[model samples]
Target: MPFENEFASYEPLRRILDNEKVQQLQDRLKVRAIEHDDETISEEITEKSQVEPSEYQPDMVLAIDGSYQAVKVENGFPGAEIGYVTVASVLILLEKIRELEREEFIDPKQFRETEKAATIDAVFPGCNVIVDDEDSAKSSMRRILFDELKNHIVFSEGETLLDTYEALLKIKLEQKSTPSRCPHDNCDAEFTYDYGEYQCPACGGKLYSSDAMRLHELMNPVGSNGEMYGQIMQTLEKLWLIHILRAFEKKGWLMTLRRVAFMMDGPLAVFSTSSWLTKAIIIELHRLNELAKKFTKQDLILLGIEKTGTFVNHFEDLDTTKEGVADKFPKQAALLLHDEYIKKNIIFSESLKPYGKDTYFGRKFFYKTSLGYKIVPSVAFFNEYQQNLTTARPNQFTRLADVMSLLDQVVSSRYKNAVTPLVSAHAEASIPLNLGRRIFEDIAREIREQS
Candidate 1:
């Protein structure tokens, strides 16, 4: 009996490790590392690169991010879930009226601060609760999603942005072929829905329910309020702003993206949960870029930055090798940039790796703005850089050398490998350290009389 119990303990882990689903994960992945280069930085990295910076400058730099806190819903609705969220977006004008550049000999705390630093901001704060019924929960979640979008959508008297947005949403969902499958993971049989009552043929279960009996099964559907759904709320919030920006582009109100850069907190790769939204955005952007010549306009500038990466750690060594004759330690860095660097030093893999075979939504590159501090720059510049700016032809290389050209305006002395505009935006957007807990207390007191 002791032996039987001991064997059973090990079996669970072994089964989990060697399970068919687990094995499928390993088969789908491959690793890529930076081909170690033995060259040190002998000269300034800016000198050797062959590319020119655009003469244009952004009129504004806008940055957006969201924060959320989960709370307990204890009022009569038993199986109900509750959460609160705050999304902040900040705008910094690239072109400003003349202002004092600096206070002559300022205190350390306020020295780098400028009167023009912070500009317009959009902050979203709200709570969400899901009760026992599947349909009721869906309605609640959908209301939160659309309410946020409608509140944020910019408009004028004549042009209707909201109407256009709804049309786009319909097209996005229909084109992507939203999956219809049994809500039960174990009985995930596919089906077609005509917006009518249904039951799972395979399990003889309620496919669409208004009660707790179907809670677990209901979690598998696309819009279900489960773990993945919670994770996706942030992405959905982001896409709402993107859709609005694209709508503006269509109306010719913002004739030029060159005068603006949109900064997001992360990469452009859209995950499976929101692939439909991603597809629609990409398709629309492509169409606009194709007609760019006719409109005499430029493409959108979206920048996603990460402060750390595999190549970042590798740059600590800076590829040093002893030379012939003089044998002096050179300042030349390996600079594992977009082209050859992605082949070797990519850090993530499997499901979390860079989006597969599709050329990245934005090309990934690396830069060392300061010694020993490295960063991964995810910029959309490469997609349009294929030609020599005269002939329409693919450049032999990624031609990301010019990206660092704007570093002078983008970099900040306050943070390593970070742009100043983003830092300011993040500071303004962030919820205070304990504000979520305080807000939760306030809600508990108001709603349930206890905290």
Candidate 2:
């Protein structure tokens, strides 16, 4: 539950929906609708409700991958691109979980009302303590049980149930191991008579000894490094994943009954490249997905997104004059389906695609067994910059000032309700604002000359 709460805090849907820009767009749409007839308005609403045209069916699964990097700061001052985190999530629906509760065979109500049932005080005399609330009582019970278990429990391989029973039996047997009062007037130590004389390790004071010391030791055992950090990371990752899954489910994805898969950006084993804490977190994610599948009867798809630009260069071979420029993007070529149903018949591969004039980018290739075409966006077109009207990184923009001026022209002269302000804000925080503005102006001048 705590994890669920934490995950909701990071979701961006609420922010995007509530944005002023989005509100303005809706307002404009409303005005436009008023100008149209009632029949036209109804048609518009119906069209908006229909699913967008796509080669694949709406039932197809989605796979997501996210990557994060810490932005380096100078003397605590944030630099451009600093504090900027990018996440890409792919979703693949493969299976779903059915809700079911394990049945309790016996009637607990009848057992509770029976006279033969044991009372708390009768079974454990003097063990009861006063508590301010029910929560405190439960906490006290847990502490007592934990302390008792740690003191006398010894486990063996494949003996989990037997070990628990033996532990309980040991606790019952040692219930009479209460400490004896010290005879020394100067000292306040308590000890058992069976253990002979007792002395405080810190002070030279002598006293009687008992089994209470063992209980104290058991209640405060030291934990290992792997257990502490591992548990924390595991909890965080599971909560985050669940939150995303729930969001998709709410968006009409059949997450509960259909098989779903996630594509992670890294290796399957987190410990391979990531920290031990990170590995623990990923393992927890795997466990949660497994549990989700079991409950929903859905299968999960997990794939790691990889890049091979280091070994091969495909940019040299791509012809820039291709008709479907948008269809040649590397990412489009590398698209993989996590669903088992899709994978069994699809021959998945990867190709190095050219971006701009020289850059090599990763592309996914999915060939279906059935006769149909899968259209994907081109790598070069996807990477192009609208402000510059050029295929270059923001930092590489030659006339940044010109680019901003061009953007201004587009916003003022063409689209009145454009979201350029938001885009400019993001660019300002990421790239050199002055340079970007110049590049925009130059781009605008180029377009004007061409026209």
Candidate 3:
């Protein structure tokens, strides 16, 4: 029979569906049921009303968010992919947020005056951009990243984003060299960096501060660079956060740093190949907080609020209740999960490897606002992987009271457990997914045809 006439040949589909062994296999899978009104759980939940208030209201909130898309062109001889990343930081006055909150209805005229913030976008080469030349894609991508990093004007006085990246690396990891290998094919020669800039002695290829991210390792001649795109977006988002804060400090604007709450779109963690940057970020955050404390007697209000992930699921489970049962996790409360709780409940691992030890710059806390929004906010800590840290641990929840205060004013019903600044940041950073991919594909096809 021809392949086109073989549609109904699979009799095993019915057998597989009727198999009792499949059901039994699922039954044997280990999955913890959500607990409601348990003693151990109750100890972790600290109601917001019970915690002491900071009386520290922020004047402004800066939310940073990013998005990335990769498009593959099927029409090309060897096929190709193009990736784009957009990152935006939006600054909105706290008074405006409060005004909007007080008034149940939003007014169109209230937004007549527009505000400008930082936006950084980049297009990257992926897959077989250069059909005949394999090394061209890798070399071109490296050059593009180098140009993008150093060329962007982050400060009015002529400081670039590359400068900020180098400064951060120097302050944090300059004492210890970061190791990496050359990206050139067949030349996996190892090297170390005391700082951001280094030239590969083996291949004589130039490296920039952006290379420290090691995103190039994810790039290849044939495979898609979609992963690299996401990694780059993340790295850029983090850099933007530090760049803006560094700018404020450079201009002697400690007051702005003190009264401003910088909201990040995701957890304060850098994962995958870029995870090494977490140490640098944690150290920098501490340095900045210390600087603000020295001048303003307060720490900088910076937080990463996650909308989705494993912790969000755990938080949702905690907030839920059976029909007759009382609430599992009370409203207006914050639960800081220790390593034991996380391992036993969330990650399903009793492994000795501490959770988020290598990747996380901050510790995660599940907080339910006074208005009943479940928020997973991660704040930078001096040492998140300390032994014997628990929910009742003191000094771990630094500026947490202020975070709760800020949450009360900016609740959003647009999405479940959403906040306004993040909503704004998302809108600013969002790209049209399907339409963007189609457009890029068409452009790629056209370029291929012309060439």
Candidate 4:
């Protein structure tokens, strides 16, 4: 009876380790690791035999694209405008990798080959071959470049660049007599076709293919809601997953070699986005935590940075009820609640702090939270902009401060409204204020425990 009771006490941890779902996850991890090894060997042999010595160093880089299409502009600004921004973060073991010998860096390409091979092997294995004896290494590489690299490089058309790469690679593959075939179902067709159109003789199915379509498919596959809203949600979810993985890979490599610090440019959570998308992203992130433990054997710490002045001052000035305060607390509070919900659910790293307010040309006062950091807009930049026949500088500052100040107030007001008969009947369901507060407290507690 004592032994049984003790075993029952171990249930939670044991479920994490010994459950069937956990075993399946472990099996997938093992398979992935084996596949990664094979890919590593192939890449090492290929790079060592072909690539020049200079290219062998750890020059691998990751770039991400963040774009916002303004569907509706407030206060008589342009009705719609698409703002495109690209964020590129470099991950290099500058201190550690540089310490290797010149021979280690160049001669047999040991260092370069090892890292590249490991990345290739670990991220994706068995990607170079097809089931039917067709050598698809070039196409596989094209898919990777198109799906991962192009969109992140904002200046060029990702699809166009991928197309050019595929064409060049196809030429090389053709010279080696590798068979290129259509991937359509029930079609046993092979053609040394160029970059454009191919028609299947066996099934009459037209293949209008390009690297762009391939990338799109990766994000929004066929038979899985390709509507614009669906695509946007899918893209955001993919970005969230990729961001976590990339962060892990960055941190994992650093910790593997014993490094202390790392930095990120923006907040831990991606705010100014949709609520549904945010919730979906957080769900995927939770799943990623399980996946990361199985694959990398590391816990992810996503620390959000905030500025004390911004967080405290904004909350303080939410209402015009006080001197030096402005109105507009309602909408702002809603936005904060939305963001809080996201922060409560997603998991990330803890190595860096977030800045919440701008103090100088280059520096700012930063704050850290369980979710991530808060980044402030520069006064000078906002001052230069004109919106609704008024300088946006004052409005932006006032609105931001108001929103921060009124978060709790607005939430309280909303809670009262939810209880009101008219709204309660009209609205099928509403998130209670107490429940929201409890969620916030729970997240704070979890973060504190982890810290």
| Candidate topping lDDT | 3
lDDT of 1 by residue, 272-366 (tens): 44444454555555665555424434445666666655544444345333343321222212232433234345544334233322324554444
Ranking by TM-score: 3, 1, 4, 2
Candidate 2, 360-402: lDDT as tens digits: 1112222111111121111111112321221223222212222
Q: List per-candidate RMSD values in Å.
A: 11.1, 28.0, 8.1, 27.1
TM-score of each: 0.60, 0.23, 0.84, 0.24
Candidate 3 lDDT by residue in tens digits, 102-153 = 7878776775222234466778888766533335777667767777777664
Can you tell me which runs of candidate 1 are displaced by over 4 Å?
Answer: 1-34, 40-49, 76-81, 95-99, 102-128, 131-139, 156-179, 182-230, 290-298, 309-343, 348-355, 358-360, 370-373, 381-403, 432-451
Backbone clash tally for model 2? 74
In the range 198-276, model 4's lDDT, one tens digit per residue, is: 5555666444334322322232221221232233322332343344343344334322211111122223333322222
**Model 3 pairs in collision:** 48-332
Off by over 4 Å in 3: 1-24, 33-36, 72-77, 100-106, 112-116, 130-134, 171-173, 194-198, 323-328, 382-394, 431-451
- lDDT for 442 in candidate 4 is 29
Better of 1 and 2 by lDDT: 1
lDDT of 3: 0.70
Q: On TM-score, who's better, 1 or 4?
A: 1
